[model samples]
Target: MSTVEPAAPDATTPAPAPAAAPSAVEVRETQREASRRDEIAPWLVALEALRRKGEPEWLAAQRDDATARFARLGFPTTRDEAWRQTSVAALARTRFDNATRGALDDALESMPAFRFGGAFAGREAVFVNGRFMPELSSLGKLARVRVRPLRQVLADDPDALCGLIGAAADDDKHPFLALNLAAFQDGAVVEVPERYTVHGPIHLLFISTGGAASHPRVLIGLNRNSQATVVESYVSPRGAHSFCNAATEVLLGDGAVLDHVRLQAESEKAYHVATTATRVSRSATYRSHALTLGAALSRHDLGVRLEGEGADVELHGLFVSDDAQLHDTHSKLDHVAPHGTSREVYKGVLGGRARGVKNGLIVVRPGAQKTDAQQQSRNLLLSREALVHATPQLLIHADDVKCKHGATTGQIEDAPLFYLRSRGLDEEAARALLVWAFAADVVSKLKVAPVRESVERFLRERLPAAGAVPGTRA
Candidate 1:
């Protein structure tokens, strides 16, 4: 028997130390950035695969800044204040290798919600994955607003998008925001010129197929005295593992009025994150109605800055979580000018061991006198294991401001349940009626009739936890 001996070390060279194993955080970070080579490029991350020729230097610089920011900050964990109640460990551990191409006709053939009708029929801008498919979208000219592809606008006249793209999403604290800004390939850009009004709501529908991640963004700019309504919806296949990181920037010029509705109804197995940054000018109004009811783990961060005097903001949200799902929301209203007004009401219903979290604040700057701000958080639990953590705060640095907040969490009143039961209604029916009574008001707040109808149908079909229709949208 012969054994090969190791070569003797040279006396002139120093011995190398044994390599150390990576820390848990380091391993997780590396896995989050895992990439695979493909036809597009050697670097195959959905984030790094994006490239454009002859793009504006400002746009390129913005993307570079976002990329560097995400690399430095990485993903937030449970230790972070804003992310304490929610966890992204599963998302970080998974390796997403594609951006999900735009060829998704077969995947969307069965989803009727993607099919727009009535007022939303001709005003739809559909995005598969993160790319815009002109074949699936309707971009006819409106009376006041022009719905154009953001990428096309950048290619044609980059100057039109200089300040509208990243003007409000410059937050380094939001890793998902940075990721979306850095990687977004195509999105809708709705532009309303001065003194014009858009009679109908412009629907921006983003659909994600399975096995990949997508970064879809929206840029809406309403000039002086303009009015427009925008509805943004995110949906995916049922129980499909995917990631949808979306961002929307809304700039309301002076005297502008904008009505925005956001609907998140993703797959039960998906991970969803969204950030909306809006700025309101003098006498401008920004009203938001957000409904969150999907994804295994979902989170939404909304920030509205009242930059001009007499600016107003109204926020209304309804989140439903069941079957071990987790839904989280963090919202901030910054009153930077006097006479600014803000009103917020967020509600959640948790069942089947689901969990809900909300952290919201209304901050008044020193000079923001007469800042009338009010916030409320209401939650209802259907089972003993269902839980919700709500924090509605008011931070006032101004003296003459009226800022107040309230939060309430509890189960349905037994008196009402008994009353309904005495009326010959079954237990599940009674509970469903009560839950609908609690959730319907918020759904009505949405101005889009088609979206409102869809939400109402989902509520009727899936509510009353014990009677939840299997295979139906949760």
Candidate 2:
């Protein structure tokens, strides 16, 4: 081979400029193309179908933007920093069809018992397969409170819906949220005007049918000095294989107070991913209780932003996993203003080959002086193969702030078990007693009596020899 001599450069000629970097949009399109190769075409088809159904121009634009965002971010893999502890490869590989209509008649007739009636009474809004079913919903007589289907609200006032849809939770960071915004058909909308206090809790019930995927969206807003209590329950028929991607956004005005509870008890073969974002204004109080008891793989992302002075937030969560199930709860509380207070307690019980994860973070931004924040995560493993990962972190960039975080992962202490056994309790009974006692610390924080009772019932049904516990309320 003959070597070619290099051409000499001219003194008056300038070197060619380096190629410009790809624009953000172009880079995003490249990512979207790569993600589409991972079997995300079904979702793309679903979004197109929604657009072809004559949706409002504004809504369609929003959906298009969200779809683009989702395509860019794609599904999170184990390689992602935020998802390093969790893997959703199975969910990404599976081809899921969107739930377009309500549940079939036979499916509705064979529904399971309603365990949350006591908590919501007659003020309940029911959704089947992600579509609102007015016949099954009973929004009886709540003064100064509006509870309606989200689709109806959107149809009536697109502007109002647009204002609340992406108010909390940035879709740019969470791909599932972008998917939800792109494909959600119907959900619940609850609004409380200024100085109004709802008499009873407004309940939102989401029931999934087998096979298809459901995207549920919930938005709750409280005007100045308003108060309300809301409960959102997700369930599916036994043995159903479904996918549920849900998101809820809450906005609390000045001096407003809200008590929110979210319960996820899906089928064993189901996939459940949810995000809840709350913004608390001056002197507002926001309390949340999250319970995760079912699903083959589940993840809950809870975020609270204390944006105004004197805002208070309390978050309580309990998760029980068994038989190879994975349940994860990630919480972030940001104290951005002075005098903001936040408290978080999360507990997990893992049995069989199950795995549990709890990640709680408390952040005190600069100028957030006198911010009192505390977070605790406690986990118990009942089987040798069971595993739990607990991470409690405090990031403080401000001085004169009181912030503490603690995490513990271990098996039940021998001393407590021995004490219970000495009191004539069997091994199973003692274990159940200890587990319930651990979970009760979070459940008892629920101020609502009926809600607490329902959680107790759920735990009793799942725990071994739970009925043998001494007291009625664990």
Candidate 3:
């Protein structure tokens, strides 16, 4: 009788479903708290040092402008529309003093060395802690292509330098960009003459070694019918704690073509914030590939503007994060001229308790008739605790333009995992195989095969044992 009474459905009791795992939201909150606490003292020191630098009058004016802007528009918060997915609170916590002029740091000795086998062997520039190192730099001149340090360029052509300083960073609202505009120490200037073609790739290495934050800049200009390839790498030793605020400005004239690639693999405790600003002229073609592999907190911002008709631009990016790292990418494409086209594809792989954010925006101006733009972002979470936020947006003012945007966030494919396992592979082997295959798309797009192989090797060395197949050779 009692069993029969108990069998009656209990309104307060229900069957328990599988429990969902906790996310990294709590970890992110903790990190934010730590960031805010550590960032203040350095900032005050930087402001005072910069005020006393006693640079040129124009430079002083620029610094004043930047300081005013920084005071007006501080670090972005989650409430900011463009920064909803990525918070700068941690960055705001500690301010970095202006990097001190010092000797080549010993901390840089442990960084991954840049090895050139072919194509890129003859063209190279090495910068240590935001300063060019002549002894470490080597390059064979290409016909009609000139590459030199920014200080040299400024001394040789002041007008060009002034133009580049503004061209590289015109964003008054962005504090970091303005700060870089006012405070960058030494940078690179690359100029490609009209109607000339560079057969070999040019490699630029940027190594951050000091504990102080440094700002490095690069200016690249291509004349009509010119063609060239540029590679930029950012790296540091293990567990190094520093800040890198860098910027690159590129201009492509009519019929010009450029292949630009940036590989960022810094120290696990470092902070990286970089901007790539590009303007494409009539009928020009610009292609860019970006890979981010390190840093405790890293943010990559890309701004591409089609300034002339028939300009075409393509952007591809990949980010891999593990441990407690935070990775963020903010990208924008502006179709300002008619008949212009742009395409963007971004992919991310996150493991452990890492967090990733991708925000891509495409805009077609009113007079940009027949403009075509496509944007896509895809994310893979290898751990239940990992978190990824993907957002793709389109703002089109032209009615006749064709524009599309898409975003996806998900875990690894079970079908692929099962298929690999069916072939006598262990769970770890299957997972590694799948991860490699997932990352291959971006790697294969590299213009040079050696670079692609190098990237693959880096991935192999960094990925978890479970995410790397046994006996696999990169």
lDDT of each: 0.82, 0.84, 0.78
lDDT tens digits by residue: candidate 3, 1-474:
011111213435234435585346555755855554345335635665656453555656766777666545556677556567667676676555445454255544553355444446558887877878777777776656888898776667655666556574565656678767656778888899999999878888888764767778998889999999999888777776778889899989999999999889888988898889999999999999999888998988898889899999999999999988889998888888999989888999999999998988887877889998999998889999999888787777779999988999888888988998898888877777778778777877987665666778777776655445433344
TM-score of each: 0.87, 0.90, 0.86
**Poorest 10 consecutive residues by lDDT, candidate 3:** 1-10
State the weakest 10-residue window (summed lDDT) of model 2: 1-10
Quote the positional error of residue 335 for candidate 3 in Å: 0.6
Worst 10 residues of 1 by lDDT: 35-44
- Order of models, best TM-score first: 2, 1, 3
Q: Pick the candidate with the highest lDDT.
A: 2
Q: Rank the candidates by lDDT, best first.
A: 2, 1, 3
Return the clash pairs for model 3, or none.
39-93, 39-94, 39-95, 40-93, 40-94, 43-95
User: How high a TM-score does candidate 2 get?
Assistant: 0.90
Which parts of model 3 have CA positions greater than 4 angstroms off?
A: 1-48, 51-59, 95-103, 116-119, 465-474
* Candidate 1 TM-score over all chains jointly: 0.87
Error of 2 at 388 (Å): 1.5
How would you encode candidate 2's per-residue C-alpha lDDT over 1-474 as one tens digit per residue?
122111223325234445598666567756866775555666677667766465677778888899998877778876565677789878888877654354455347544354454446568888887888887777776766888898898778767776668888768778899999998888989999999888777889888777778889999999999998898988887787889999999999999999998889888999999999999999999999998988999999999999889999999999999999999898999888899999998989899999888988788888889999999898988899998888777778789998888998889999999999999999899988898888988888877676677778877877889776545632
Q: For every candidate structure, what is the RMSD over all alpha carbons to the true structure, in angstroms? A: 10.7, 9.0, 12.3
How many angstroms is residue 37 displaced in model 2 relative to the true structure, after the best TM-score fit? 2.6
